[model samples]
Target: MPKWISLDFGAKYKLSRLKLWFRGDLEYKDGNYPTDWDVYGSNDPNPDGSWDSWTFLHHFDEPYKPSGLPHKQYTQEDIDYARSGIDYEFIAIPEAYRFYRIKFNETTGNGAFIIITEMTYWGKLEE
Candidate 1:
């Protein structure tokens, strides 16, 4: 079972990179952030919500972002990184997909909720 957050672009586009910023739990010591998750792409005109339906883009297990450690203390770099956001660029060009989705499988604190400051998709519209 996957809890997919789907996005429809209305048309195909060749994707470039993904930028994300988490600003939900920064106030807390051990804030909530995605520790492990996945990204998927799809051009299926009609998807049926099956594991085999979406295109597996990448399995993100080691995304270097930022963190507070030792005694729930955040560094200057950590603060900046969180505020500026991080980019996850595609190593190679991927096929155009009109629709994209994210399956948020897990998070760092595994708290009751997760907050995202922003989510930006970098790509060029397909002709």
Candidate 2:
């Protein structure tokens, strides 16, 4: 099954950045971290039916590696770093969106599951 998550801000806002944190786990780690993902934004509350209005906000050509250390051998600092989500800065676009979606295509070790500890988005409300 494909993995995805969506968020509705309830009202349109000028988004600036997004943050994602990975779960701290060494074993069964295939799906613990995402290797490829994309983010989309839309003004429509329901964008699943048609993605025509959804704008492609960002895409990762390469997987994100939170810690430089190996997955199984993570130091305390590495674990702490992983727990703290990494920030993804969005383009300086003035568009406002009420809906946001994140799609994950691949994970660490290519496991069948994807694990995320937390997710956060920062932006200003549309004036």
Candidate 3:
């Protein structure tokens, strides 16, 4: 459910092509409004081994909707909701980052979804 992610290029990364995907509901629990989401560099890990600098690239609130059964995974259904859906949003990382971390504010609540069905991070491999 709640986890951290890292991507190391071992060189440099294209800030503009940074992308991510999540298959299920990413809605935080009650009052768990993430103040901001961040991306950091492992090369610049902090004292706690967490990425440093990790700039705020971008964040989304209810990015996408689905077609067909409105499920978590991608489907072949070409419904209008699918086209207008934004389940995933691309963000530009900083140019100097060698490793990155996606951070979000944590919260707790009953009958809430604290899970990330699926996630992905990819782009033009930097070298």
Candidate 4:
């Protein structure tokens, strides 16, 4: 089983950097990955009707070997760590009118699994 992480955006400021790490062994067959995850933000806690569309940030495999990484950039098991490891990062935090939120959707198999590990909010407090 693999692990995932997320961060929350609020009604104070937009995010600039996001760092994430995946723990545990990951296995992929035929080189197919699920498309999930979204960035959201709003003032209300519920944040209903106030969410951005789902987007693709990054994709990795158990071995981290790209079917054809240009220039042979990434190597197999590039992010594989038996004891400790780090996985992904995002530099551009969407220009949220107010805040930012992260939604993870892992809809791939008959069994649906989506988990949130971390959620941090970065911004100025409202007066």
TM-score winner = 1
**Tens-digit per-residue lDDT, 19-112, candidate 2:** 7776656422567767677778888745355557678887763334455555445556655665566667877755888888787877766766
**Best-performing candidate as measured by lDDT:** 2
Better of 1 and 3 by lDDT: 1
lDDT of each: 0.67, 0.69, 0.44, 0.37
Please, what are the lDDT tens digits per residue for candidate 4 over residues 1-127? 1323333433445444443433233322111222345554454444343234434333422223334443223445442431133234444544443434444444223134532233333334442
Error of 1 at 115 (Å): 1.2
* lDDT by residue for model 1 (22-85), tens: 7744732333456567777888835666656678776664346366353345677666776677
The worst-scoring run of ten residues by lDDT in candidate 1 lies at 24-33
Give the TM-score comparing model 4 with the true structure, all chains together: 0.41
Pairs clashing in candidate 3? 39-54, 40-54, 63-86, 64-86, 64-87
TM-score of each: 0.76, 0.74, 0.46, 0.41
Roughly what TM-score does model 1 have, to 2 decimal places?
0.76
**Full-model lDDT, candidate 1:** 0.67
Q: Per-residue error at 27 for model 2, in Å? A: 9.3
